[model samples]
Target: MRLNAAPRLPWMLGLAGLIPFVATAAATWLAPIAWQVVAIRAFLGYAAVILSFLGGVQWGVAMCRERPGETPFRARMLLAMVPSLLAWPALLLHPLTGAWVLVAGFVLVRFHECSRDGRTQLPDWYQSLRTLLTLVVLACHGLVIWRLAGA
Candidate 1:
């Protein structure tokens, strides 16, 4: 799909959603040392939430397109739940480890989304937007990891 063909609102909202990732990542470096731990926790929490939301998006897609009792439907539903499952454990780990977990989660989701079956199920615009957003999110996670690792 042409880049401009993507709706403006989702793009706007998606970009807006990056605020917390950006802000918290910045806080990890720029905020007072006392607040750094809080910022790290906040970053992990937000990443987990967003990862779950992405899974929900997959669920929504499956619900809208697949018929009940079908193998494809079951498979898609199972895949949809994977992100939330991955995100949950990250919350209990150290900030550096948690950031790496989230990084892997985002990459796995995006990789699936780029697969042939995934490309067929989702809109071209949605796929494009997801790719872009996932890249930025991964970069933010990298920043968090860098900070947490004392780099």
Candidate 2:
């Protein structure tokens, strides 16, 4: 993969990634009703799984649009599922999987977007903010999982 020297990395992709995280977190934390938490987490969990797959399709779009010097990043993008896919099943079976499936899936989608254009086509601000936001989302998911487990 040729290095992208210019501002790349699809920074907006990172921000796009933040949507689910922020939305999920708000639904969980700011809501007055308790069922809202369950509704948000359950729906988001499933949606995250489906969306990651969709994001992969979008990833294909980027790969197809590959510039002359770019390396095929689709393979790397696909591999991000290792954690999420595994966690997803563990979540269903054990319920103690920390529901990391959703978190992993979310990150995979974000990483898929952020890593686009060989990491050079994106803006730096977007990447860092995305990374930060993603981590926060992951942390929130972990907390949610723990809460559900204890209940």
Candidate 3:
């Protein structure tokens, strides 16, 4: 995945996406108790949002085909909703569980996007971006889990 020369938008957005995760992780270590709580909630909430966005990307890609001839539209749409469905429930669980679920969702979706059996067939560059973003997200999530466990 050669995204170095890709459009600046995805690259910029990809980097920007790290902000919440990084901030939350930093807060987990450096912020006061009240602020840490706020940061953890914010991080989990943002994780859910991003997971849904990734699902929507799959939905959009599946629906974008013009001359589609029975491409399992129903199944594709249903599959596209899986991430959001997973995310919503994760929000209701314990913080550790929720973070773990989000990490799982992120990684699972990324694998799907990159796999041949995957629902969405994205460009290599996009896959690369997803990988980078997922790594940062997982790291932040790990930090959250560690902090919560130590608490």
- Using lDDT, give the best candidate's number: 1
Q: Which candidate order results from sorting by TM-score in descending order?
A: 1, 3, 2
> How much does each candidate deviate from the true structure in C-alpha RMSD?
1.3, 6.8, 2.0
Which wins on TM-score, candidate 2 or candidate 3?
Answer: 3
* Better by TM-score, candidate 3 or 1: 1
Cand. 1 TM to true fold? 0.95
lDDT of 3 by residue, 97-123 (tens): 999899899988887777774634455
Scanning candidate 3 in windows of ten residues, the lowest lDDT window is 65-74
Score every model by TM-score.
Answer: 0.95, 0.49, 0.90
**Of 1 and 2, the candidate ranking higher by TM-score:** 1
lDDT of 1: 0.87
TM-score, candidate 3, is: 0.90
Per-residue lDDT over 24-123 for candidate 1, one digit per residue giving the tens place of the 0 to 100 score: 9899989999898899999999999999999998899889988878987787899899999999999998778888988999998888889886665787
How much is the lDDT of residue 39 in candidate 1? 95
Rank by lDDT (best first): 1, 3, 2
Model 3: runs farther than 4 Å from truth? 66-69, 119-121
Comparing 1 with 3 on lDDT, the higher-scoring candidate is 1
Distance from true location, Cα of 15 in model 2, Å: 7.0
Measured on C-alpha atoms, candidate 3 has an lDDT of 0.83
